[model samples]
Target: MPVSKKLPQLFYGGDYNPEQWPEDVWLEDMRLMKQAGVNIVSVGIFSWAILQPNAENYDFGWLDRLMNLLADNGIMADLATATASPPAWLAQLHPESLPVDENGVRFSHGSRQHYCPNSKAFRHYGQGLVRRLAHRYKDHPALAMWHVNNEYGCHVSRCYCAECTVRFREWLQQRYGTVQELNARWGTNFWSQKYYAWDEIALPAKTPTFANPGQQLDYMRFMSDSLLDAYLGEYRILKQITPDVPVMTNFMGAFKPLDEFEWAKHMDVVTWDSYPEPTAGIPVAAAMQHDLMRSLRGGQPFILMEQVTSQVNWRQRNPLKRPGVMRLWSYQAIARGSDGVMFFQWRQSRAGAEKFHGAMVTHTGDENGRVYREVAQLGNELKRLQALVDTRIEAKVAILFDWHNWWALELDSKPSRDVLFLEQIGHYYKALFDAGIAVDFVQPHADLNKYRLVIAPALYLIGPGVSDNLEAYVQQGGTLLTTFFSGIVDENDRIHLGGYPAPLRKLLGLCVEEFDPMLPDQTNGLRVRGQGDLDGDYKCTLWADIIRLEGAEALASFTADFFAGSPAVTAHTFGQGKAYYVGTHAEDAFVAGMLRRILSDLGVQPPVMTPLGVEVSERRAEGRSYIFLLNHLDQPAEVQLPAAGFTDLISGRKLQGSVRLSANEVLILHKDTEHAV
Candidate 1:
């Protein structure tokens, strides 16, 4: 399902909190919103205290007024369950519901997200409020969607309270039938820590030494599912009351604590908040986040749920979104497969933890302000581009990102903590980003037949059926590019015997003899002497693998260390397909050149090749394509058009051969549109 379940038009606007203002200012806020071309606003995201002043009493008068006003003003509300924060009354009443840290200190309620996910008291009160909101707004004209809760597990991803302990025991009992089985699976025999009863089992918490790796892994799985259960508690109620309405919760991009892939399976449409630094200038990080969000739902067009109009107060140094930066980045969101453009707040808070956070209406409250003007400009452009709504970006390439591997690779007892999961994967993704290649961030189990090339980096843990899936994909003529630190362990964090990366040894056609974790400042030389476009000398970092080929032929080899001249990179043919393995991480020149060769071999061309600091992406309709050209440089840049001619949907100007974009400018060229002058 798309985010446009209720409205087919491009959804605009930001998080609206009329309760933050006086009754008199509500009308003025509405006027400002309309002036900004706002159509949709997420209401009541953090209004639990005002909605339900106490556990027993209900107060919908303010919300009722707000909903009515929005409906009257031609605005739709992404109504929240108001369960983001527990009320002060509930916290005061049930202190046990407060989350306890690993050190056994209970967090007191003053700020938001004070309750534990597994807390019975929290769910009881939270679900009760959700049911009432659903039934009340089931028929409201203003309700476009249901926002279940605001960023689940943001603050309290884990709890070490007594309540959690009991739940953990029960959860373990269900996962492993008896204590004997649990001990065997967790390898408790090693430290004379074998359990005799389920009640003896505890969460992987503070200890004199390192905790059991197996216990730590299961706890990670448990917490992710626990948070999911909490979300589904409210999600079920909303679906039961308003089955037609879509439900979503804004995801924190690439959040470490929670597994977003599993959560995405239960969502109606994916929506996430992105707060990229304006000082960074280039939107590389933001693009990866957008691709991950879109990939969560299999390339579905998602809403840009919340972004700051300018600067966010959370960072140590917050800077403004220089002039056209906001509008250019907004189009970047659209280009990467977002159907809607929105921000954290419609109106700036006069006083709160986020008062300094930028908004459409700034602290000065001037509609003519730079932020406000840019937001209105974006909204105005979005209104005319409704056709881009529900449009999808088709990519022939994908990058594998598994939270299981992410959790396992970075565990305390790893080869090198410096070999960060995101860093390794981000390195590969940056190559694709630089080449103007669209990519889907898929899990290993996802279907690979649709992709011409799949890049799997740092696959430290291989779950059941993943190797079989990869083998099948390769046998069916798919191209695979996987890296080192892969296929070493099972899902249980146990090393496979016989050889390093034993599972993938057959498919990858190679066996890793041993791997060296390089120092922070270490670099190994790589020489791809005869690998076509990759025939160059380059440096590798972070990891170096000494490989002995079984059936694979070396394409590139290490030129430094004792492992010099061994297979640093290899190519193996399986059935009708080819699998390329980089035994060690290579430099950007090598990665870019290798990707260029792989993409060129598969005939996957960029939407439009552009110079540095310029990004090109496309969204496809029935037979139409919207090519977005974004200039991220401080000076003007030009891009040669892939098509002969097209109409600039933004300025409605005819463009052909090549187009020039001013510094921090964007142009959405509509391919084969009748408006082509």
Candidate 2:
């Protein structure tokens, strides 16, 4: 977790807002926290209004007493800088700090994240508060970690105000270094959109009809960088004052507005909030989020910063988390490589918008409630499971994920409106997850030589260095699988000249002559022509490419499209390994069968085979493997033991045969072996 020396165990608490309750209830919070085996609590996340009521007035007496009480009770504090929500006084003094929407309407300062990213007034006040907090808490005994500003771009990712427009011009200047280069890259000569001066450039605000795709893509980049500048402002101050205290900000899983890969580089440790909807694909989606967080920093152990104890108050239909579902999800996070299990809040609120939100201490203030009892049980289990901290899930497979590609591919003038980046990512990742194969999410230009199998899905926009990086990986005997619509455009959202997939044509041994984007209600069939392993007749939808083979051989052909006999799937042998291309978005049956066969050819096996609803994952450290078996079904299920004998950490039971698990069950087993780390 890379925290202070005072916190040497697993973290197991949530947001603690002592300012919400009176002094009497504050004392009760300490008692309940101890009773629930809580070791750490996030303090003062949204207390700016009370911390400093006026511009010159500061109140620290209550917070001082709370910190002392927590330290005396043997609890650690994940202290927030209190910069997420601006106080009412700041808003009244300078309303220009308020953010504006895309339609040129400025939002009133009532909700959280109401300030603009480039507002000078907001930065001035935010910096002042951060300096004071860092100086005051540098040597405090309760301080273990520093929480930067809340979610980076929850509501106001893009601001169309005059202030932001001026900054966007400056960003463009720095990015291009000259007006001539901006014109050349943006391809402004296409539709009489060339700019003669820097002042002519403006924010991608509401435009009549369609805006320039190049301009819109650059605006997304500018917005992402502007938010990053806000984080770095507070981070530099915290590090200069308290260099020993680790600093981080909470991330929303798979958030598209801001680039998480870039943000993870500056953080001391990664942390994110997980709020998966109660749906059929909950297990796979939650695991994908965990893997994405863990992969942000090259497989560093992250913390589950915020999750619901039971029912949340925000969703359209908030469903109460069934009994044992909370614990099951927590263990799933740890299984993928999370060091801590935390929640959105410690005690449920009695007022405000989040009063109905579940917490460790319920509104009834009873320690005997169903949700509170489950929280206590899980906290105690975490205390005994501290040995699993810092362990890693070492997967040999890597999934390429790039935010630039995602943003550019989903721009307005694309081939198909139904084609999205995350959907294709989910398709590829689910195939691996359902087979019980752990996977890591990586950027396009990252080092891919360590992985045996690399899967890139819907890589519609390939930059300069990415092609070289991927080509070298395939040349060095690594298996690569990419889908349709890849290698189409460069970083500037300009199509590559000569042919489609131009950069990767030699490596893939095929060319996409044309993209046949199917309408939302259309479908296509996939006829298997590979080895007699998969279903002969499979269907696809959303997209099918007319592929022309250069040196590759067809593995599957489209059945109902104009290019029915053309290659829908092809396999080519590049330098010492193989590269497969799927010219169509086939259904799960075909994708899963092909991926499983490829993994079998590489001799990469799953940890253990289980029933349909059961998930198996393993983490290894110090010559020992910790196996996690979770049942995501509503009914009981059984799994065969993959080893001769092992010790169960949850029940302290030793077994050598099959084990039966009730609904929503979890069994963390330990076995000694030499893992190929």
lDDT of each: 0.88, 0.89
TM-scores of the models, in the given order? 0.98, 0.98
Q: Which stretches of candidate 2 lie over 4 Å from their true place?
A: 279-281, 672-677
Q: What is the lDDT of residue 370 in candidate 2?
A: 93
Instruction: Check candidate 1 and list the clashing pairs.
Output: none
Candidate 2 global lDDT: 0.89
lDDT of 2 by residue, 55-104 (tens): 99888889999999999999999999898999989989999999999898
**Per-residue lDDT of 462-505 in model 1, one digit per residue for the tens?**
99999999999999999999999899888888887879788888
Collision count for each candidate, in order: 0, 0
Off by over 4 Å in 1: 673-677
